[model samples]
Target: MQVHIRYFSVYGSTQTYAEHLAGLLNTSAHPLEVPLPDDATPVIALSPVHGPVVQAATYARKIQGRPVAVAAVGMTLLDVAREKDSLRKLVPEHVARFYLPGKLEFSTMSTAHRATLASISTMLRAKPVKSANDKAMIAAMGTDTDRMDFAELQPIVQWVQSLR
Candidate 1:
């Protein structure tokens, strides 16, 4: 059971998670890219999921027909079953999925990401009272915040190990 670790991170949380997993698994962590090793080696991809983007999907497309496990890093939480359903069409149906909480660094984001978040925050704040979900989004995107915890990776690591 050979396993490979790969990752794509915009703000470094995903990379950190991948590196930790790599260390624990004693494997190398590669950045998600083409020209990957041609083998039946299963991949554990640590990627971030933003508003409408999920980095793991790109890797999944590139490695079609292979066993791929996705560890999604994000700031928001959603029902795992529902999230899996939403991503099923983009990723392989057999993919093993995991959701890991992520952090936000306003200063580290691209101008476009910052601008887009700001726009959404503005809209959310316009309403005097926000729903819990909206408020959570606003707070996460509105300020520089860190919620990353290595402990959060335990389940993902255990799951990946089992794949081996």
Candidate 2:
């Protein structure tokens, strides 16, 4: 089946997941900015959480009425699974939502993001809180290695499989 994997990956975790998934399904992933006019395939909009929201609502708005699924990549996936409000804010009206954790390397962060992180620290009035040790488990490597294990990605994989 033709599938459109449109993603907005800031730190690349979701992009890695999209690439891995595309390889598994033998499809190519596309950027959200490019229009997919002739391809009638359904879409999967993958994004990561930033500050207070998933980093690309404008991109999300672009796919509103299309046949789309959304997966929110974040650090709190396991901890916030039952938080309907957070999940809702991530992927509203999506056919399905997948919670995937994200990783960050301050060195790799864009100047803007680094600045934003610095700003957050100032606001919180604390030494920069690193990605907490408790949340850095292998499973949480979904955020670290910029790769998510296929087994862990199965929920979205199964959903895509079911679509065909």
Candidate 3:
């Protein structure tokens, strides 16, 4: 089966995941800004935590009515996806979505992301989650980095392959 993994990544983790997934499947992935080929290849829309904002949804719509998958990477609570009503609606039916842990360097993220998070934290009357794990994650998220263990893609890859 032919597959097209098209993705948008603000911090690059999603793109890195897509590339690794494509390599494992022995198929090429596409850039989010590019046009998907007209041929009948199943499209996978991948994105980072920015969610529907990154136009992964718009890209998915271009290949709508075809078999497609949507996967997102983010700093998630273990069952965040299951609990999030908004995320449920954002991920389309033909789209198989999953989340992997994402770490963001305070310095590397766009000012908009940092500001938004800061605002959201303040509005919620909470400080950023200051767990030991969180601290380690952030410290490792050096400037100019979007590092992730490719193993996170395995479950989704196996599931997608099963669809063939």
Candidate 4:
């Protein structure tokens, strides 16, 4: 079985993972904007997570009824149950899900995104009791923190290989 890799990336982290995963699978990665060659091919759609939203939800919906896996890239630390629960609301329950840590590059973000993050940071800072994750997010607001590790993609690679 041949698997196709498609990615929707705003800040490039998803694309990075997509390409690496493609390499591991001996396939090339294509942007989600490019239509898949066929409906029968299994797809691994990767997208960046913006809070509760998964950017590739629309694409995943369009590719329904085939074998599909969604890899959500975000800056937050892993909480499998939380992440999976968040993803279930956006992606169909039948779609397989995975989470990978992504980089936070303020410089690469658009003005609107930057402003939104600033607003969230302000809100989190105002909380009287903040969790460690909240504090980490606040600290990471303006800095470029690279949390992308190629080794983190091993699980994805294994999943793709299983298709064979």
- Give each model a TM-score: 0.83, 0.70, 0.76, 0.90
RMSD of candidates 1 onward, in order: 2.6, 4.9, 4.0, 1.8
The local distance difference test score of each candidate is 0.77, 0.64, 0.66, 0.82
Give one digit per residue, the lDDT tens place, for model 4 in 1-109: 5788889888778898999898888899999988888567889899988866786766887785578888888877766434445677777788877888889898888
What's the lDDT for residue 135 in model 1? 78
**Which scores greater on TM-score, model 2 or model 3?**
3
Candidates sorted by TM-score, best first: 4, 1, 3, 2
Ranking by lDDT: 4, 1, 3, 2
Alpha carbon lDDT at 17, candidate 4: 92
Give candidate 1's error at residue 76 in angstroms: 0.8
Clash counts per candidate, in order, are 0, 2, 0, 0
Better by TM-score, candidate 4 or 1: 4
Model 2 pairs whose backbones collide = 102-143, 103-143
lDDT against true structure, model 1:
0.77
Off by over 4 Å in 3: 51-54, 126-147
Summarize candidate 3's per-residue lDDT along 1-164 as a digit string, tens digits.
67878888776677778888899888977788778777777777777766345356656655755677767677544355435634456655666666666656677777777777656445444435565434443444334334466787787787777878
Candidate 1, clashing residue pairs?
A: none
- For model 1, residues 1-164, the per-residue Cα lDDT tens digits are 56788899887889999988888878778888735677887888878887767888767766765678887787765444245545666677788777777788887788999898889889988998887767788878757877677887677667766766
lDDT of 4: 0.82
Look at candidate 3 and give me any clashing residue pairs. none
Best by TM-score: 4
Best by lDDT: 4
